[model samples]
Target: MAHQTPDLIVSRRYLRLDCLCLLLLMLSACSSSDQIEQQSRTVASASQTVLMALDAWAAGAAPTAYTVDTLQSIGKTLADTGAQIRSAETSEPTEQASLTKAVNDLSVAVTRAEAGLQADDRLKVQDAQQDLRLASRALATAYAKYFAPKP
Candidate 1:
């Protein structure tokens, strides 16, 4: 049996500690990647919902021909999508906040459109439509900022 020197014992302990740290780092990185992937899927799902609602609204046989019920339904869809976006977890706090704000703005615009439909006010509806377009743009920007491929 050989007696190990103090330096050898210290070196072995240091190597073990280094290995532990590396393992923890790898695990954290994998967790982060999984989180980002989940967030991307959530954003894609919400974006699809918004786009579908927009398409349905635009598919009316005639321009400015959406019924009150249709407007209400679209508004509800927008609100629900916003809720989904809000519930998604993101690695970027700033981007998450921006996306949340954009989604909330879209929901508000849709609500206004629904109100306009209920009031039979074409001007108000048009204004809300414009706001919706802007909100959509903002949301797209935020989504890209957070979910864009890293070079």
Candidate 2:
């Protein structure tokens, strides 16, 4: 067999390099998607916590301080995720849309929870509870549709 020329060897090296670069690119893309999905789950779980708080409040139980605190913590997580989203340079479509939807859903749920806290009326509490549950369900559905692994 003929020995390969130096130019042919150099060319082969670059072709492998090209393949390596492409594989890295694809993996990074997939990782970004996974991050988005994780972020979406955070938002959904936070929304669910808010809903749970509303339920406790409406059931005539003393306001759920733990749940309130959990919701607040989740709010902080969402805010951080928002910053990540704004700073991202990737062109991943699904993750971008997922991040946008998560933020919107969490914002609405938080607003409702804040309103409930501000209200002195029990009826207002009930209304806020209903709103929180509805919003949480919607957010969860969206996340599940886009990112959740199949059961």
lDDT of 2 by residue, 43-146 (tens): 66766766666667667674556545666776677778766654555555564665576576666566656655655555665666666666666656655665
Backbone clash pairs for candidate 2 read none
Deviation (Å) of 109 in candidate 2:
2.5
lDDT of 2: 0.66
What are the lDDT scores of the predictions, listed in order?
0.66, 0.66
lDDT of 2 at 94: 68
Best model per TM-score:
2
Question: What is the alpha-carbon lDDT for the whole of candidate 1?
Answer: 0.66
- Superposed on all Cα atoms, model 2 deviates from the true structure by an RMSD in Å of 3.7
| Runs of candidate 1 exceeding 4 Å displacement | 1-66
